[model samples]
Target: MKVKRYVVDDLPQAVQMIRSELGSDAVILNTKEIRTGGFLGMFRKKRVEVIAAIDEASRKPAPRPAAPTKPIVRKSEPSEESAIPAVQLPNAAVRERYARSTGTSDAPAVRTSAVPSAASAVAVAVPAESPSKEAPERGAFAVPDDPRPARPVQAGAGLAENPDTASLLTELRSMKEMMVKLSKQQTFRSMPDSVMNWSRRLAEQGVEAPIIERFAEEVNDRLGTEGADDESAALSVAREVLLEWLLPSAGSGINSSTRIVHFVGPTGVGKTTTIAKIAADQSLTHHRTVGLITSDTYRIAAVDQLRTYADILNLPLEVVFSPSEAQRAFKKFEDRDLVLMDTAGRNYRNELLVSEVNSMLSPGEHAETILVLSMTQKYGDMKSVASQFAKYGVTRLLLTKVDETDSYGSILNLALEYSFAISYITCGQTVPDDIRPFDPNEWVSRLLGEPAYA
Candidate 1:
């Protein structure tokens, strides 16, 4: 049996992975948990472990000969239950097939009678038979040690009849593959030299071949570009690479006809302050008549922040208590070129409150709901926040604290997966100087091996 750990968030990766691997008849035995181990031998990350095996014990030696890749890796491979340890088994099919073909009873067998017929090569022992012959599902097995096909091969020198031992080793290798891909994805996105080297080190270990190829392609693209200056082009390339991750959209659910730009996110995310910055930038520099509306009535002194900016610029400030009041405030700003609305930060999962706030800031015809994300925030937390606000009609994004985080992997994830234009980035609380324009040339250079900027 073979098991593999994949870090992707969903199941398509698991199924496509099995098909790309063990072939059509590969029977999935069991799938469950894994600990993404760390320096202290690590904690569990609850990743899904796929336990799969080919139904036919090695038919012929694996069509592809095993490569003596690099860095000696040792794992216990038992030929049969209670048997002596064998050399590293290339694929479960190869070793098991060898045992079966060599007339050795060490290999387990499949009994047509034992495994539910519906399961076919995948012997999950589904109690219900498949209505059709072509759609047999072997994924329904309840036993963790369930056989891919059949049999009993538990009498040998020392190899116990444990089904998980072999799968665990394979899964470890698979995890190495996933980590390598993750490093590659991050490298192309962040261009962190350290990650590129880590990818090299993992390659010396046992990451999968296809994953290696894709990573190699990214690295090759970096080096092969002709006349590409690294040092000076840093900013431009960084922007381009980041944009590739972002791949801006044609506008999502946001209605441009509405001119209300609402900044809402988790508490302590600088939502109110950032709104002040954008409002000032637009009013002072862009020469646009910016109107300020605050719906953060719950938090004391929230209005003070926006009011301070309004006082300095002589811009009108709208303080609203209810979503209905917020709507009326938007009406007052209807004639202004830009309306910057600030909402009280709340628990993102508090859908009821978010919906109410979203309803208030709903652009009449010119405003776009742009979620403000802090670079200093944790990636998982950021993803959750993004998902939560996604339901609130957020289509554009404004990244804050560019100077804060060194590892921006989550930014890459959001850009690649979600089509959101990063309108601007702010490094500090300063309204004008801290805010920088979003440029793609800088993004691409950084992605293609440019050095970090000063």
Candidate 2:
């Protein structure tokens, strides 16, 4: 099979090229419109790309039956020249005209001379004349003693009636049907002008298209149902729907009997610093007995940094290298009212590292696992990063670096997408001063571009 691709200005040109190169047996496999030569999507030219194929074996014409010839007569005394009977055949032009006149072309004219046998004359007679000569010049017809198999009458069918042509038409119809279905889908995907306006607004605010579409669709539905078509009414509906669907994470304070908190997130997400701030609050501000355990032994000077905070707060800091050692450290701090576990910030995208961290903390046994994400990162990246942490265990969301960007769409986006509770928001790097528990109403107001709730 020979397959080719052609890009042309229109369908007719593509068809002509396919016909000239692949002949009548070619099949169109696929076609699509493509745009090229655009700078920033301006002044682009559209072209049609067509894919066609031809099966080399199917393109060969089926052999037709030759015209019957008379048997050659051989004299008892054979002359040298008479020994081989000279035969002449009609040229292709004569054969074509004969076919048109009689509605058949299986038979052609053949002139025969006297010879010894039917096979000898049949072989020797045909080579005697040039194929370019006319039928009359080739002489009269002859019938052989033993006739060859006759070509089927159906072999003379027109090009349109050919089996290969029928197969090609079927393929073309299938491609046309597929193209129609794709066009319908393209039409269905085009959004209304109002919906598109909202989509642009959300995109400017750094919200992903899928999330914007979901909100816009719901807003439109509510407006239609309430018999309101105004833009302000639509915006109001959108805000209300978003607020209603934004389910804030809910949780009770840690168990009074024993409290353990583990902080986990990707690299440089402020996991260690966040833990320090929490430790200072629990020990100094809340006046509770707090012990700190860190499995951040992978990096240089990590223990020193945490130890400095531990020394200032006068709290015991135990650094463990392995999961078993971590278990022992927890056992040693069992008498304390609260034990804060700070894990090293590594690539959580690596499943092995996440599993190792899970083993080290033994989360969900008695401790609350918090996944920390940064508001500075894109929502698209945050979703993937959060999912990797979610695989092990994540009870709450500890969103950090809120002061870095005014847009807080990532907070709302993650809340709706993953269904995880927003636990705390860390705005600045200040220990114990910048971190605060999440407030649902205040966050919703910020997301809607309104004044934050007091």
Best by TM-score: 2
**All candidates' lDDT scores?**
0.59, 0.72
Q: What is the per-residue lDDT of model 1 for residues 57-139, given as tens digits with 9 covering 90 to 100?
A: 65355664333232231222422232222222223453365455556655443322232222232222222332232322222
- State each candidate's clash count: 46, 6
Model 1: ten consecutive residues of lowest lDDT: 135-144
Per residue, candidate 2 scores C-alpha lDDT tens digits across 1-454 of: 9999999999999999999999988999999999988889999999999999999999999986654454443233443433333333435544554456557645354343333342443232322333322322222222233444344445536456778988888899999999987875564365345545655666666776568767767766676744344666766676677677664564333445547988888777888788888888888877789999998888788889889889888999999998899989989998888998889888777788888788888554567888888988877678887888777657588889988887877876787777888778888988878888877666666665654531
Task: Give the 10-residue window scoring lowest on summed lDDT in candidate 2.
Answer: 134-143
TM-score of 2: 0.57
Model 2 RMSD, rounded to 1 decimal: 18.0
The C-alpha TM-scores of every prediction are: 0.50, 0.57
